[model samples]
Target: MNIKIYQRGGFKDNHDVLINATEYFCKMLMSTRMCNTLNIRLEMRSTKLGKNGLGSCYTDALGSKKNKDFIVIVKRDAPITDQLKTLAHECVHIHQKATNLLQYRLWKSDGKFHARWNGEELGVYDAIPYQDRPWEIEAYFLEDIMHKAYFFNNKNRPDLEEKIINGFNNALNYLESERSNNYRNIVSRQSNSLEMAI
Candidate 1:
C-alpha cells in the first residue's frame, strides 16, 4: 500500500522506526495487489485515548467496496511492542474493510453507526460491547498471530528476523547518536527487543 506516517508529540523523534514498522505491518497483512491499490495513513498521537484504547481505524467510505483509503490512529505513548500490536490490529481492520468482509454505515435518522459482516447487518455499533464485536474479535485473534509470526515464527520469511535485528540495532544507534533524552527513554521502554528474543 501507499503508506504515509504522521507523528505528533512523543513520536516525532522516531519517525524512521515508525515508517519501517508500518510498512512491515501492511505488507504482512495485505496482499501485493491489495497493497498496490490502497492508500493508508498511520497517525501516531500522544494524546490520551482513555483506558484500554490503544488504536482505531477509519475508512474513507461506509461500504467496504468503496473503501480504498484508510486512516489509522495509534497511541504513541505505549511501549513499542504494544504500539506494533495496535498497528497490527488496525491493519487487520483495514484488510477487513478492503476485502468487503466488514462494512459500516451511519444512519442519518438515528445518528448511530451500524456494521455489517459478510452482508449481515449487526445493528448499532455502540449497542454491542467493544470486545463482543465480531470484527474486533477477528482483529484481536489475528494481531497475536501477526506479532508472533513477526517475532518468532519466520520460516515463510527467513530474512525477516535478520532484518528486524538490523533495524532494531540501527534504531538504537540512531537514538544514541542523536543523544536525545526522549529517544533514549523510548528505546529503554522497548526492552522487549527483537535482538533479545531472536
Candidate 2:
C-alpha cells in the first residue's frame, strides 16, 4: 500500500521518527485496492483540540469515484498505539466514504440544514452519543483486528502468534477503557442517586 505522510506544526521535532510507523499502520489498515490505486495522505499536527477528539478523515468535498484521495489528520504527539488506533478508525470512515456507505441524515435547525451520519450531527462538534454511532462502532470493531493483523504480519519472532494475540488483547483492553470512560458519568450519577435514596 502506498501511503504518504505530511507532518506540520512542530511535528518534525521528534526528529522525523514516525514516518515508518505511520506508513506501516496505514498499509496494514487500508485495503489492497485503496493502497494500490489511490494516493492516501496522513496529515499530522501537534495541537491540542480540547476534547473535540483525536483524529478525523475528510472526504466530503471531492467527487466520489474520480477523487480517490482521502486525508486523515491526527495529533502528532499522541502515543504511538493511539496514533495507530486513530488511523485505523479513520481508515474505516474512508472506506465508508469511498463505497457510498456514508449517507447523511439531514436535519433542519433554525431554518438551516445540516447533515449527520448515523444520528451524529456533522459540522457541529456538540457531544454525541459516541458508542451508539454505527460508524464509530464499526471502526472500533475493526481497529483491534487491524492492529493484530499488523503485528502478525510484521513480527518475525518465534512467538509471533503470541505477539499477535497480545496485540488483539491490548486493543480490546483499550476499547474497554474507552467504553468505561464513555459511561462513567452515568454510572456515577446512578450511584449518587442510590446513595441519596439510602
Candidate 3:
C-alpha cells in the first residue's frame, strides 16, 4: 500500500521533486473520505512522455477484482508545479477506477484485442472528443482544484502565485457546474418517480 516514485531522463537530478509530489498527492488522497486507508499501489514515474502529453494514468486491468495498480507517468523535466498538477490529474483517474465510475473492457482489433474505457472500442484516447470524455473532463476540471489547495497551503512557492490564482478560479467554476448538474439529476429523478407513482 506504499506509493513508489521512480525517476528517469535526468529527473533523477531533481529527485526531491518526485518525492515531494508523491508525498503531497498521497496526503491529499489519504485525507479524502472516499480513501479510507489506501491499500492500492500507486507508481509515479517521471520520464519522457508522449508528445503533447504532460502526464497520463492507466492500469494493467480495469475492474474491482482485477489489478488496482495505477501507473502515473509525467514529463521528467516539467516544472515542479506542473508536475504536481499532472499528479493530481492522474490521481483522479485512479480514484475513478477505484470507485468503479470508470471501467474498461477488451475489444477485438485486427485479430487482436485492445482495452478501452467504458466499453467504447472505437473511442480511442485522442479519437474521443475532449469534452465528450467524462473521465477526462472530471480529471481536467478537478486537477486545478487540488493544485490550488496544495499551493495555497504550502505558501512558500511564490513562483506559482499566478497559477494558484488561476487554479482557484477554475476550481470555483467547476464546483458550480457540478452543483448544477447534481441538482438537475435530482430533479429529473424526482419527476420520473412522481410520474411512475401517478
Each model's C-alpha lDDT?
Answer: 0.70, 0.59, 0.60
Which wins on TM-score, candidate 2 or candidate 3?
3
Off by over 4 Å in 1: 11-13, 152-198
Candidate 3 residue-wise lDDT, 102-157, digit = tens: 66644355333333444334344445566456677667666776777677657877
Over 1-198, each residue of candidate 2 has an lDDT whose tens digit, in order, gives: 446788766646533334454455455444566556655677886654456577887654432233366777887788776777777678777766555445433335543333344323454323445554545765766676765555555565537756665665575566446553543544565568779999
Best-to-worst lDDT order: 1, 3, 2
How well is each residue in 1-198 modelled by candidate 1, as lDDT tens digits? 677888755646655655666667667666778778888888887664667789999885465455788888888888878887888788878877988878888888898888887677888877977755657755764575566556553356657766654554464355334332333444444454645876
Which TM-score value belongs to model 3? 0.61
Which pairs clash inside model 3? Answer: none
Name the lDDT value of residue 136 in candidate 3. Answer: 70
Highest lDDT among the candidates is held by which one? Answer: 1
Which candidate number maximizes TM-score? Answer: 1
